[model samples]
Every structure is written in structure tokens, then in C-alpha cells.
Target: MGIKSWLSKPLASWIVQKQKKWSSDPVGTQKNVFDLLIKKAQKTTFGKDHAFDSIQSHADYCRLVPVREYEGFKEYIELVKQGTQDVLWPGIPLYFAKTSGTTSGVKYIPITKDSIGYHINGAKDALLNYVHQTGKSEFLDKKLIFLSGSPIMEKKNGIYIGRLSGIVNHHVPGYLRGNQLPSFETNCVDDWESKLEKIVDETIDQDMSLISGIPPWVQMYFDRIEERTHKKIKDVFPSFSLLVYGGVNFSPYKRKLIESIGKEIDTVETYPASEGFIAFQDIPGQAGLLLLLNSGIFYEFIPVEEYGSANPTRLTIGEVKTDVNYALVMSTNAGLFAYSIGDTVKFVSTAPYRIVVTGRVKHFISAFGEHVIGEEVEQAMKNALLKHPEVSITEFTVAPQVTPEEGLPYHEWLIEFISMPADMDQFAHDLDQEMIQKNIYYKDLIVGNILRPLVITSISAGGFINGMKKMGKLGGQNKAPRLSNDRSFATIILTA
Candidate 1:
């Protein structure tokens, strides 16, 4: 074997040992991280305002700083934006991870010198875990592409600002730089279509062993490759072995992406956000990503059903139970305290704390009070895939039809198909059956005749793509919601 194949051996072993050290004592590890974060931020403006010095426990924390979203913390962020020092964390933030928001126009999440390693290490440990599990690393030496946002960034108030992916782009470890593909200039193109075309030109004929991106954009890249080369990705790059993805559940996109690749390959799922890196899948085929207990963050969870209450029951690591959905909250080294990042997760394993991202807090269907969530819809689709091998779905979304023109209200599923089922009525029947089985409320609604059986709307090929482009969310971390409480997305899909 070449020397490159051996490089991951020691690194993987070291990472595994380090992870085991923390995983072995999940509660204590998190406690230490919590104390360190609180102790370090005591002098900052936020800490002083929240009386951090007097806070002694999670109960004290819950009382001192109420749970909030980005808007609630915008006061400190604004202070930092105006050249305030020691406002959020110690000194000024090194970078602001600029990300889009539905309510807040543009959010600037702070990252400090002390906190930068969380994002960097989050990526590293995930890849190393893959290496240790598979006993292979030669993919590191071959050409690879990270289909990410442009690396180019700007400075605001003397702090660098860019997408989280772009901020991390500047920090790609030197060892991997040698094999990174799609030249920097191409990556900096800004316009996704133009950048994608340039990326195809740069790497189509070169050796590419790894590709990483959100599923839809990655699918776009594969489509472009097949269009140009007239070959499956497996045939074009036989050595390609790993596919790393995150930012969306993979089940809906799984069959389509695998077919494009033309074979099975190892895949890794990561849970990363501007707030912090939450988890990574540690074992192959495991149900959920292992939570980062020793990372520079203190975690909190509020039962999803109780989140809207004036005083919700907040639980820390040791207090949480398996299979219960909770709204993920965190207080981080980056200076977010009791902050809600809008994601919901369920712990599949509590002994070592492994969690599956169930859905987003606001992304659900309850127009008729059925309260169907993203996870239920995705699980139903997964069952559909297993039941109907001939049916291939490319993209799909669910929204409530509260006021149908003729009949009682119902849920509408818009699906874009690559291969249609021979029996359209039977396909809808199977999908509805799974959906009803997964969500008890939906089943109740159906039985009471408050809502009718869901209807299916077939979308032409590239329909969702055209719709996303129109919404200006066509690439780089953007994803179509699997379920929506409103008809905004449904309108777009119908028109597209």
C-alpha cells in the first residue's frame, strides 16, 4: 500500500481514543464543558447581564437566561457588529457565520478563537471515524471535491464574515489541500450554475474519489456529469468510495443519488450548524449521529410538545430519555446562552448519547390540528421505497390543503418522479397507509372525516429545480422542506 493509505491509521486511532475518553463519561464530560464555558464567559457583557457569576447549576441557568432564538440574542450581536469588545465572548469575534433566516433577515453568529476548533474538529473527527471503521484512507490522496459555498469573504467591523462553509473553507487542513479539486477561482464564482459548470470542466476528466455536498446540489452535479460523460459516476471514477452529506435527511434523496452513482458507496452524515457542530455518525449503519458531549458547548433539551409553554420542562443530558423528541438548545463557547437553533432531535441511544435529527421546530403540518412532522413523512416515504422498488422519486413536499375546492380538507403531497409506479392509485394508497400508521393524529383525523385521504400531485422532471431557482435557493446548503405548515411552498411547486 502507498504511504497515503497509512496516513489515517495513527490519526484515526488517536481520534478514536480521544472520543472514547469523552464517550465513556458522557454526563461528566458535558458537565466539565459546561463549567468551562460558564467560567470563561463570566466577564463578558452577556454573562454580567445574566449574572453568570451567581449561577450555580442548570436550574440557575434556566432561571437566569430564558431560552431564545436568534432574535432574542440580536442585542448582543448588534453590539458586536458596532465594534463592541467583550460583548458576547472575550475580545471580538474572529468571524461571523452569515446565514439566511426566515424571520431574521441576516444572522451573524459569532465564532471566537476558543470556539473555532469546534467546527474544525467536528469535520476532522467525523472523517477519521470513517477511516477507523472502514480501514481505508487512500481516498485522501485522490482528487476530491467539496461542493461548498465560495471561499471568498469580507470583513465587517474588522471581523471576517462569510457562510459557515466558506469560513471553514479557509481552514481546510494542509494535508487535504493537495488533493482538493475545482480550483479556488471556480469555487469563488458566486453564481451556483456558473460555478457548477466550471467545476464540471475542472474535474470531469480528473480522478475524483470523494464528493461532499447537500444532496440536491450533489445530485445536480451528478446529472451534469452524466450529461457530459454519458457514464454513471461509478464508471467515470471507479475509485470513488465515500459520499459525505448533511443539512438534510438522506432517505428521500437516497435512491435517486445512489442510482446516479450507479453503485453502493460508504456514506457519512454530519450534524453541523452555525450555532455549533452537534454530532456525527460514529458507527456505520447506526441509527443516529453520536452527540458531541465534550465539545465546547453545553446542551439542553425541551420536549417538543411543551416548547410553546411559558415554562417548559428543560432537561440536560442525564435527564433526557430515549425516543422522545426535544427541541435542541445550547449554550456555547461562541456566547449563545440557552439558545434554540430551531432543530428537533430524538435520542435513539442514551448510554452514549446518539441522536437522530427528527425535524425542524417550525416545519410541520397542523392546519387541521393533525400535527404531522417531517420525520413521519420521511419515514412513510422510506416504507414506500421498500414496498415499491419500481417507483423512483426525485423530490417531494407535503402541505395541508385546508380549503380544497370541492371536498373536506386534506394533506397534498407533490412528488417529482424519475420512474412512475405502474399503479398510481396503489402507490398513493401505500404511502397514505404508512403516513397514517406513523402519525396517530392523522389517523384520527381520517377516521373522523375531518380530513380526507391525502392526494398526490405528480410533478414533471426538473420541476422542483425550476421552482428552487425561482425562489433563489437553488444551491449550496439550500433544501426543499419535506413538510410545511403553510401553502407558500405548495403554491410554488404547483406553478413550477
Candidate 2:
């Protein structure tokens, strides 16, 4: 924590008070928030009255909006580039948060002055709340290390630009910025191979106290560091206090990462995006609290259910139930109204609205007419890993593919490990058994022999995510598809 962070307790209280006033009201709060956004959106040339309508008018407005993906927003981004004031918000936007989605190559998401301030202040509030909940003051004095994307601004026509990278490069507090190590931008490495090398070199001598980033990148950094130093990260950053990360599920990699760190570092998950910072871990022991940026955006949830079901129920903050998954829809300060992010989340509680991200709505495997969700796969995998004491899985990937001769669909598990059972057949059988016990659908499918179980051991040190990173598709909001129902990439991996 920095000096500003220490002084932000009052600011945190102010934000909380405002949040309480808004969140507690529920119905009136949402209407007010939506109305405010509508007033703002009405000013934009692209905005229409239908775009700003309520959740009940979703069907009517959705067609008008036409589900504009990030690519559709590229024109608005170009308008920003021209330094025009005709884009989503008033005046020139501060910076763009670069994020990649399924089809969008690289989305330069506009972050207005107000949006940036909201994110910065929200971050402060979250930190201060963490301090209050944990009953620890050590964080206030320790140096924080944010494992983020390099703050390299791209020069176009002699003007430096690059939305997200520029924001982090320019907006970080000056004092803390000076103490930070080299970013991916500082190093002359544009490709993953050299970038990982640079990351290893920069942190070798730093007195890092906290680490934060996407889980896969963190794993990659530690793996590279270990290879170079012949010591785990615990040996390198002995004073490390916390591991804060989000952007993907951490449960699968938690055990290994904990072991590598050697000491029990406090773990915190943040549900942030290029669009906005939606939620953060408020209390230390409690699950993450969905601190709705009430002033920043309006939110709605659609109950997740099987296909061919009745109309999905739209939920307000008050209506959300614990332990049930919901598809999130948002209308943000930045022009995206009634936007579906394609992610799924389950509420741990409703009063404070704490949620644990269940999985991706797009990343489900439904072979043999059985819908196997990402959470189910993750839970089953975790359970299977717990059964073996000697085996340690560092990373893994699952792809649904059809067997060559039989033309039958099956799941191919690509597992990377430190050690494994010498009898490969027995290991496979045990893993299959564990999966069966964990997920009934998978069990029934296996029992019916519609999907044959298979596992491939990768000898490569960095594992599947590293392979994806090498292809320039890792970090930020982009993640390696954990459950690929499509057989395109699966067939290649299975054959290889």
C-alpha cells in the first residue's frame, strides 16, 4: 500500500456510503442508475431511446442494438483516436483498456475520465475494505507488485497511444511507479519467448511483496523464474504477502501455485474487465462481494438453465439467489448497455451480493447430448487431483474430439505434471473413476461408452497455456478455452 492508499480510508467510507444508499434501495436504485445512463446515452449520435430502455424492453432494444461486439466498437475507438468528442462520453476519453474477446482481435475499450476515476476510487475502496476485514496493517507498509501487461504506448504518427497500456503507464502513482520493475514494454521483447525471458530477468533482484495478474501468466512467470534461478518463487520473493488475481478460474491451479510459493500467501480475486471493475474481494475470509458500481453502471442477471427451457428470468440485485448460476448482463458508463459478457457467475450470498464466477457460457462441452459445464469439469478435476499424493498437475487442457476409427466423440485431457503413475493405464482409469463420481452426466456417458476417456502427458515445462501464450493469445481478458466443444483444435492435439 502507498501513502495515497493509506489516506483513502475516508474515501472508501464515502464510496461505501454511496454504494449502500444505492444498493440497499434495489429497485429505485437500478431505475435511477439506468435513467442516468439513458440521459448520457441519449447524447451520443449512435445512441437511441430503445438502447436505454429497461430490462422488460430487452427483446425490442436487443434487435436495435444488434449485440454489437467489441469489433463493432472499433469505429467509435477510431473516433477517439481522431480526438473527437462525438464518441460515447463527452469530451476526449482519457485512455482505452485493450482487451481481446472471442472474435475481436484487440479491442481498444474507451475509458472516459469519469470511468477511470471510478475504477481508481473503486480499487482504493476495495483495498481499504480488505484491510478492515483482515485485521492486518502489514499491507499498508509493504510494497505492492502488480503483475500486469506492459505499459508500452504505441506511437502512431508520433503520438503515443494504446488504451489500457497507456492508462497504467501514465495513471499509476508517481512514487510507486518509480519503485516498480521493468514491464513487458521496457524490454525489447515483442514475442512471448523473449517476453518471458525479460520477466524472469526483471524480477530476479526485486523485493516484491505482492503479486497480481491472470493465473496462467502468474504460473508462467514463476515457472520461468524457477528455471533460471533453480529455486521456487518462495526463495526469490520471500517477503511476498498476497497473491491477487482474477480473469479466470483459480481453483485448478491453486494447489500448485500455493506449493510453489511455499508460504500461505493471502489470495484475493478481483472481477475486473476492460469495460469496468464489477466486483472485488471485500472481506478476507468471505467470498468476493459484488460491489456494483451503482453510479457507474446498471446491471441485470438472466437465470442460467438448460436449452429449450422457458424464458430466462431477469434478476435484480435483490432477486439473485445463492448457489445458482446466472448469466450477467450490464449497461455500463462506457456505451455498452444491456451487454452480455458471455460469462456465468454463482452467488455465494445475496445481502451483500457476493459471487463466485462459475464459468464461461460459451465454453461448455455437450457431447453425447450431455451439457458439461466448466465448473463441473473444474470441480471434478480438482477432486481427481486430490486423490493422488505423489502426482502434481501444473496445468491442463480439455478438448472434445471424435475418435478416428469409431467416429465417436470423446474428451482428450492434456495434463502437465511433475510426476505421474508409472502405470499409465491405471492412472487413466483412476482419473476416469474420479470424474464419474464428481459428475453424474460424465459418469453416465462413460458408462454408456459414448465418450472414451484418454489422457496425454505433455513433457513441455510450461504446459498448454504457455503454448497458447506463444501464439499471442494469453493474458488480459483472453483465456485458453478450457472446454472446447469444437473438434477443430482438438483433432490436431489428439493426433499430435
Candidate 3:
């Protein structure tokens, strides 16, 4: 092993030990983060307007500050965009993470001087924890690729603005520069298809070890490699072992991707967003992501059912229970106070606080009385896949078919199949049965004749991919919605 690789294992051990101190006392660590953030922000305009000086506890904070979504919080973000300093955080933000929003056009999420670590070191700690657990540090010497958006950022109002992954791309530590693949020129290509071809060209002959990206995009890379070499990904990069993925559930795409690689590989799941780097899988093959309580963000949970109620219940880390869904809210050093980032999570374990991302708070199918979520639709697919081994898909989505020309309204399944089942009629039956088992309201609707059984609509080859490209949302942190109440996204595919 090289000298740097030899030293990494011990350093990994040290980092994990230090992190354990905070995880062992989750609530106390969060209390410390809360007090520190409040103390630092009291002099800022938001704090003063909300009477932050007199706030002493969660109850006091909740009374003084109402939870806000990005639309509700845009007034403050507008000030930062205008180069206003000390309007939210103590100083001007270091950078703004530019992200697309459905209801609110483009969102500019601030990354303050104090909160950059949550974006940078949080990824490092994830890798170090892997090394500490498996004692494998040799990948540090081989090539690693983070399939991401263009790292080239643009300046606006004297501050940098770009996608979160693109912004974080600029901060990769010096030590990994030699081992990272996909040259900066290749990375800056605006067209995702063209950029992907160049990435395969650059990395095909190198000694690859680590590959990270959303599952769909990773599958695209694997497809390109197979087309050129006529070999599985494992055959092309024999040393490849670790797969790091985030931003969407991997289970829906897992079966097809595993076949594309032609072998099983270790995987790490993460929960990262523009607002914060929330959690990651610390132990390989673990069911839940370990929440980072001691990071510069103080987290809160509102039961998903009570999220939009007039007086929603707010709970700290200690108050959360396992197996119940809750909307994630946090006050970060990044100047966001009681901010709900629109994601809901289920605590799989609370002894040390680990969670699973359930769905977006707004992404649900409820045109009728039945309000079904992302997790259920995903679970239904998982259940159906188990019964029919011949079934595999490129991607799929669910939407309420509220109006039909001939029959009662029903749910619609838009699917792009890789290997179609011999009988799609039976396949749809199995999927509908699974959905009914997971969601009772949908079952009641079907039985009462208010809704009919689901209809599966097939998208032609490369349809979803082309639709994304048409919208200029082809790659890098862009995810297809699992469930949308409206037909806009589904129409993009159905008409394609």
C-alpha cells in the first residue's frame, strides 16, 4: 500500500471513535447545536424579527418561529441573492446551491461559512466510516468517479451559484485529485448524453474502484460500457467494489443495475440535500441511514400526519419513535430556522437515531380520497418484483387517472420495461394486488367502484431519458418523481 493509503485506516478509526461520542448521546449533542445556532443568529435580522434573544427551548423556538417551506422562506433568500450580508446568517453566505423547485421556480439555498463542513466533511466521514468498518483502504490509490453535474459554477451578485453536487465538486480535497476520473473538461459538458460518452472514454482503461451517482444515471454509464466493450461492468473494471448512491431509493432500480454489473457489489446509501447532508449508511448492508445529530444542524421531526395542521407537534431527537413517518425539519448554521425541506422520513431505529427517507411531503397521489405516498408505491413494486422474476424495468411512475374516456377513474402506471413479462395483464394484476395490500383507501375505492383497477402505459425505449433531456433536466441530482397528483410529468412520458 502507498503511504497515504496505509495511514488512512488508522485515521478512519480515529474519526469513527470521535463520531461515536456524539452518536452515543444524540439528544444532548443536538441541544448543544441548537443553543449555539440561536446564540450566533440572535443579532441577524431574522432572529431579531422573531425575538430569538428570549428563546430558551424547543417550545419557545416554535412559538417564535413558524416552520416554512422554500416558498415561504424565499423573502430571506432574495435578500441574500441581492448581496445582503447579515440578513440571515452572521456574515454573507459562502455560496448558494441552485436547485429546481416545482411550485417555486428556482430555489437558492445558502451555504454559510459555518455550515460548509456538513457538505464537505460529511462525505469524507462517510468514506472513513466505511474504511473503519471493513478495513479496506486500498481503493484510495485507485480511480474513483463521482458522476455529477458540471463543476464549473457561475458567479451572481459576487457569490457563486450552482447545483449542490456541482458546488461540492469544487471542494474535493487535494489528496484525491490524482485518483479522481472524468477530466474537468469532460465534466463541464452541458449535454448529459455527450458528457456520459466522454466519461466512458476517459475511465474505460483506468483502474476504477469507486463509482458514485444516482442509480438511473449509473445504469446509463453501465449501458455505455457494455455497448463499447460487449462485457459486463465488473469485467471492464475488475477492481470496482464500492457503489455510493443517494437522492432516490435504490430498491426500484437495484435488480436491473445488479444484472448490468453481472455481480454483487458493496453499496453505500446517503441522504443528502441542498439544505444539509443529513444521514448515510454507516454499516454495509444496514437497513437505515445513521442520522448525524452532532453536525452543525439541529434537527426536528413532525409526525407526517400532523405536518400541515394548525398546531403541529414538534419533537426533538429523543422524542421520535421508531417505525413512524415524520416530516424532517431543521435549524441549521446555514441560516435556515425551522425549515421543512419537504421530505418525510421514517425512523427505523431511535436508540442511536437512524432513518429511511419515505417520500417528499408534496409528492403523493391523492386526486381522489386515497392519499398514497412514494414509499407505498415503491413497496408495491418491490413486492411484485419478488413474485415475478422475469420482470425488470428501466423506470416507472404512478399517477391518478382521474378522468377516462370509457371507464371509472383509476391509478395509472407508466413503465419502461427492460424485459417484459410474458403476460403484462397478469403483471398489472399482481402490482394492483400489492398496492391494495399496502394502501387501504385505494383498496376501498376499487371495491366501491369509485375507481377501477390500474392501467399500465408503456413508454418506448429511451422515452423517460428523452423526456428528461427535453426539459434540460437530464442529469446530476435530478430525480423522476415517483408519484405526482397532476398529469404534467406523466404526460411528458405518455406523449413521448
Candidate 3 residue lDDT tens string, 133-167 = 99888888899999999878888787798888888
lDDT digits (tens) for residues 202-280 of candidate 1: 9988889999999889999999999999999999888899999999999888998999999988999999898889999
What TM-score should be assigned to candidate 3? 0.99
Q: Which runs of model 3 end up more than 4 angstroms from their true locations?
A: none
Which candidate model has the greater TM-score, 2 or 3?
3
Error (Å) of candidate 2 at residue 51 is 6.5
Q: What TM-scores do the predictions have? A: 0.98, 0.84, 0.99
Higher-scoring candidate on lDDT, 1 or 2: 1
TM-score of 1: 0.98
For model 2, residues 1-496, the per-residue Cα lDDT tens digits are 5565466566556656776776676667767776677667766755643454333343444445444345656677687777767456666566666666555666667667667766665555566666555644455454565655556666442224554533554666564565555563643344555666776677778777777777877877787787788887889887777777877778777877877777677877777766777788877757665656464877767777732234445666667788887887777777676566777888886676678888777777776666677887777677666666667776666766655456556677777676675666766777777667767888788788777775554545554655565546655435666676776444433343
Q: Cα deviation of 485 in candidate 3 (Å)?
A: 0.6
- The per-prediction CA RMSD against the true structure, in angstroms, equals 1.1, 3.9, 1.0
